[model samples]
Target: METLANLESFVRSAETGSFSAAGRRLALTPAAVSRNVAMLERNLGVRLFQRSTRKLTLTEAGERFLASIGGNLDALQAAIAAMSNDHGEPAGVLKVSLAPSFGVAYVMPLLPDFLQRYPAIRPEWHFENRAIDLIAEGFDAAIGGGFELAPGLVSRPLAPAHIVAVASPAYLRERTLPADPAMLNVMDGIVMRSGRTGRTRHWTMRDAAGNEVATTMRERIVVSDPAAMREAALLGLGVALLAVPDVLPWIERGELVRVLPRWYADAGAISLYYPTRTLMPGKTRAFIDHVVEAFRRDGLAQRLAGSLGL
Candidate 1:
């Protein structure tokens, strides 16, 4: 019989398409992942993956084995969850993935309080702008902003995010603010390269009559990090389309000015997402409750108002 640990590694490697990526998800070294797969192969007496310089591919035998064992593996996971649910106390390490900027600006600050309240539960957090596969990556939950959600995941709205065009007072003084979207083509706008979306950021707006429009401005500075983009804007490098919560403090300090306020659009809701499972573990549930309450008390809208001196 294949060990559960080896089975797990095989499954993750198959799902992620590489042993290195599977190692990242499992917090193991690539060597260790390779060892696990080799051990499983030895036990089964058949090669699972065909090795190659450029890619890893499943063998016919491996595919057949995966088809046979997949449902059983899922059943075992459900059984364990059922057992944990009977304990009635949230206990375990809850792994969560979140956007780096939002995690820094909002979530991280409140985590200490949540940790204090839930002493039995531990959290392991991954902060990045990349979209990770929750099940393959072993994340309990993910926090992000978007309307289109991944299939087979459960998403719950945390709060609504508002996007605004902003520039430093100095930058505004140096350049004429575009009165219309057409004029934006000529303006030097700071564009963000999104790792998740794989495209340059575009500013979105809605007219007075509620017609949605998107404008892709010429990029003066293309940055990947939101914090860096905000800093560049503050230094009068260019105008930036930013989340309201991020630029509100600068606005309040008179360092930055909101531009074309009437044309800004609602970006969408920020959501907490997790793989759809039959029984959610106690630790995951407790974390979700804590996050929901934190948003209720200090949501993005309230943070924006306070930061902007509204």
Candidate 2:
């Protein structure tokens, strides 16, 4: 049988489209991954990949080989891990992806307890704002929403991704509060620009009475990140549309006030995502259970609903 390392290197490199990214997932050096792939190719008497300075592409033989072996690799690894009793202690690197603002505010606190429970598991987390391909990127799990639910993946709802209009108390002190969502157009607006599209987003606000109004604001400040938008609002620059979970603390502390108390935008649900495998790693399973339980216990889902009363 070929070495497990060689097979793992080849599989991860193919999935991530580069040896460097595969190395990050496997905890191996890029040179080490390349060497393993080379040894595998030498033994099989076929070139597995077409290598160029700019990119790596699989050969026809490589594509066929990957198709035959890709799905089986996880099962095989799980079996080996089970046999070696790695599952007993739930040990290994646990890689996860998360949105920066949300992860830092809510999830990071759970790390202390998580580590205490599973001392053998090491966490390697990436804080990013874009959707991620969990399987291709070799992430054990991810937290956020708007991810494509591709095959072999599962998403569990954590909280409602509801957006509510907010502004600093100082900014609202002198100005008249809008009687309806349409009036927001005349106010200074701090808007978010889509990182992927570079266009400002507009949302239709819905009231508890089943009334919907499309609100367009005069853009006084524009930012690419949600956190930056929040800061701009806090600076009394303009009104900002933000997720309730992000500004809940500020609202409670009298730092920020809701612009339209009865209206909110339904942006979908924040979810925890993971690979849908029967033989999932113990560390991943543990983390998922921990997060779900915590959210439920804290009533985070109910608390995060921006339109709770309406």
Candidate 3:
């Protein structure tokens, strides 16, 4: 029988199309992953992958072998996890990805407690702004909004990603407070340009009274990042559309005020994303449970709701 490490390396390399990516997932060096795959090929006496400088493409035999063992690997891992749980504590490097601003403000605070509970687990966090391929990038988990749900991934919503209009108190002092989103056209607008499409995004705002209106803004300042938009609004540059969680602190501090309290754009849910494996690594499972519990205990879902912004 081949070693589990060798089989895992081959499967991960096939899934990611690169040894480096597989190594990232397995916490091995790229060379180590490559060696394991080679050893597996030697043991089987078959050429499994056509290796190139850029990527690894599986041969016909390799494809057949992958199809045969894919489900078995998941089951085997699950069994090993179950047995490990019975013998040891949850311990490993927990790799996760999250939005910089949101992660720092909310999730980072939970670190002390998480460490206290899972002393053997180490956190490897990547604070990034864009959506990432969880499996390909070897992220154990991710947290953010507006992520495309790739295959074998599941999303657990923590809060609504509702966009609210906001402006710094200093900026609004001299300007008229818009009663509605339509009136925002006359005001200086700090707007976001989509990173993928390279176009400014407009939104339609809705109220509790079932009223909906398309928002129009002057686009006086345009930024690719939400953090920049928030900063610009803080500098009294213009009104900005921001997620409720992003501006909630400033709004409570009296530094920023909601321009249209009754109106907000429904973006999506801020979610916890993970691969849909039958059983997960103990560290990953612990982290997910901890975050979910924290969100519930703090009432973050309700607090982050845009409809509650008034």
Best by lDDT: 3
Full-model lDDT for every candidate: 0.78, 0.89, 0.91
**Candidate 2 wrongly placed segments (more than 4 Å):** 12-27, 41-72, 83-87
For lDDT, candidate 2 versus 3, the one ahead is 3
Residue by residue across 78-133, what tens digits does model 3's lDDT show? 99998877788889888899999899999999999999999999999999887687
The list of candidate 3 runs beyond 4 A from truth reads 54-70
* Candidate 1 residue lDDT tens string, 42-161: 988999999887788899998998888867776777777778778656777789999877777788887899888777778889887675877666788899876246676899987656
Q: What is the lDDT of candidate 3?
A: 0.91
For candidate 2, lDDT tens digit of each residue in 1-310?
Answer: 6898999999999988899989877878899999999999999999999999979889999999999896688888879766645527777889999988889888998999999999999999999887777876778999998899999899999999999999998999999999888999989999998878889999999988889999999999998888899899999999999998789889888898999988999999999999887667788888998999999899889888898732
lDDT of 2 at 237: 97
Better of 2 and 3 by TM-score: 3
lDDT score, residue 89, model 2?
A: 77
C-alpha RMSD by candidate, in order: 4.7, 3.0, 2.1
Model 1: ten consecutive residues of lowest lDDT? 301-310
